[model samples]
Target: MNFTGQWVAFKTIVYREIHRFMRIWVQTLVPPAITIALYFLIFGQLIGSRIGQMGGFDYMQFVVPGLIMMAVIQNSYANVVSSFFGTKFQRNIEELLVAPVLEITILLGYIVGGMARGIAVGSIVTLLALFFTDLTVNNWWITISMVLLTAIVFSLTGFINAIFAESFDDISIIPTFVLTPMIYLGGVFYSIDLLPSFWAKISLANPILYMVNGFRYGILGVSDINIWQAYGMLVVFVIIGFSVSLYLLAKAEKLRT
Candidate 1:
């Protein structure tokens, strides 16, 4: 397609995705905010009183970034996976597949839409945290980059999930089993430094660990892993996810059938 036509397609997909979530604001946005508040209540106020500081910050302060990033990751993944799968289920995706828009354009459009929701929810969670704890951002660049990269990587992962999904159950499986375990065990509550040596080594293997630590570093100026390693892993996932999603889009894999 020509430049003008491509731009139009991009805008259309983005508009649709944005409107999809905006139309259901309570469903798409409010739950995460409420969930974060509960975390602060249960973990931060109730349990945190006993647990004390983590990474040299008050327990509530230490957990905020991880919670925000968690919201971003989940929402970003859910937005794309459910939206794309819904399109496929409803037979609406055929309209785009038959169009002249480049596969990457469609991917980017959906990705941006997913990231938009992710960032928006993350921002809301951050604001909510302010009510429960005093906070400071130690590294603005790390904070912004990590949030954006995390959103993009998960957005692509969700797209891949959508492509492989044969039913709504398939789409929900990864988030329920895989994604939940990763986020919970991803060092959201305590630093890996607090773990025993063997468990610490094991925790290092989780990709979400790097993301949480990196974001924790951004917010609290403390991290259990090297910031470079976190940035490197997130970048690698973004590259790999983008490539795979593009290929799936080009092939029109489960989407076309």
Candidate 2:
């Protein structure tokens, strides 16, 4: 396809994706805000009161970055998985596959959609967090980079999940069984430093730990892991996830049929 043709196709896909979630703002947008608010009330206000400080910062302050990152990660992954799987279930993905649009264009269109939802939801969570604590950005560059990279990584992951999912239940299974557990143990509410040495080392294996700590470092100027290491991990994951997603997209017959 010519450049103009590709651009048009990309724009159409992205627009459709944005419109899909916006059409149901209540479901896509409102729920995360409410859930995160509850976390602030229960975990931040109630439990955090007794806990006092973590990592030399107010408990509420410390948890804010993690919670925001959590929102971003989950929503980004969910948006793409659900959106792509919906196309497959409806048997319309075949149209895109057979079209002149490049496979990479399709992948990017869906990714951009996921990133949009993730960043939008994360921003809302950040605004809500302000009510619970006076948050500050310690490093704007690191802060923005981590959040964007994390969103891209998870968005690509969601694309992979969608390709492999055969049913609606399959989509929810990973988020429930795998994603949720990792996020909770990813230092959302607490630091790994608080854990025993063995468990702390084990926690290092959870990819979400790097994301959370990297984002926390951006906000609070402190992290359980080196910020550069976290950035490298995120980049690596993005590359792997994107490559996997493209490979799956190339297998259009298997995915669509």
Candidate 3:
């Protein structure tokens, strides 16, 4: 396809994706906000009070960044995996495969769409966070960059999951078995310093820990992990994920069954 044609195709795919989640605002949006808010109440307020300060800041303040990041990661991944898999389930993806659109355009379109929902839901969670804690951002650029990069990484992962997923159940497996554990253990509620020396070293292996801590550094000016490492991990993931998703997308047999 020509540049103009590719641009139009990209916009159409992105628009459909944004519209799909927005159309079901109650399901796609509200639930995460409510869930995160409850975390702020129960964990940040009730339990946090007893736990005292974490990383030299109020526990609520400390957990807010991680919670927001969690919201972004989940929604971004869910949007693409569910949407693309739904298209496959409906057999509509075959049309795109035979069309003149560039594969990169399709991938970019879905990536942007997932980023939209992820960022949107993250914003909502952030707003709700204000009700519980006072967040003074330490670095606006680091904060913004982390959120965007984290969203892109997970959005790409979701696209990848959708590519290999054969059924709706297949989509849920990763989020349940893999993503959930990573987020909780990724220093959402506690710092790695509290971990035993061996486990703390092991925590270093989890990519989500870098992201959560990077975001926490942006907001609270404190991090257990090096901020530069988080940036490196996110950049590397985006490059690798795009390459993998593109290669998988190019394999027509996967989408066609």
Q: Estimate each model's TM-score.
A: 0.98, 0.98, 0.98
Which predicted model would earn the best lDDT? 3
Q: Taking the tens digit of each residue's C-alpha lDDT, what string does model 2 give over 65-157?
A: 999999999999999999999999998887897899999999999999999999999999999999889988999999999999999999998
Note the clash tally of each candidate: 0, 0, 0
* Cα lDDT, model 1, residue 255: 74
- In candidate 1, the residue pairs with backbone N, CA or C atoms under 3 Å apart (3 or more residues apart, or in different chains) clash, namely none
Clashes of 1: 0
Q: What is the C-alpha RMSD of each candidate to the true structure, in Å?
A: 0.9, 0.9, 0.8
Q: What ranges in model 3 sit over 4 Å off?
A: none
Question: Which tens-of-lDDT digit does each residue in 1-257 have in candidate 1?
Answer: 89899999999999999999999999999998899889989999899888888888888888888899899999999999999999999998889888888998899999999999999899899888989888888999999999999999999999999999989999999999999999998998889888899999999999999999999999889999999999999999999999999998898857765
Give the clashing pairs for model 2: none
Superposed on all Cα atoms, model 3 deviates from the true structure by an RMSD in Å of 0.8
Local distance difference test values of all predictions, in order: 0.92, 0.94, 0.94
Error (Å) of candidate 2 at residue 25 is 0.7
Badly placed stretches (over 4 Å) of model 1 are none
- 109 in model 2: Cα distance from truth in Å? 0.5
Worst 10 residues of 1 by lDDT: 248-257
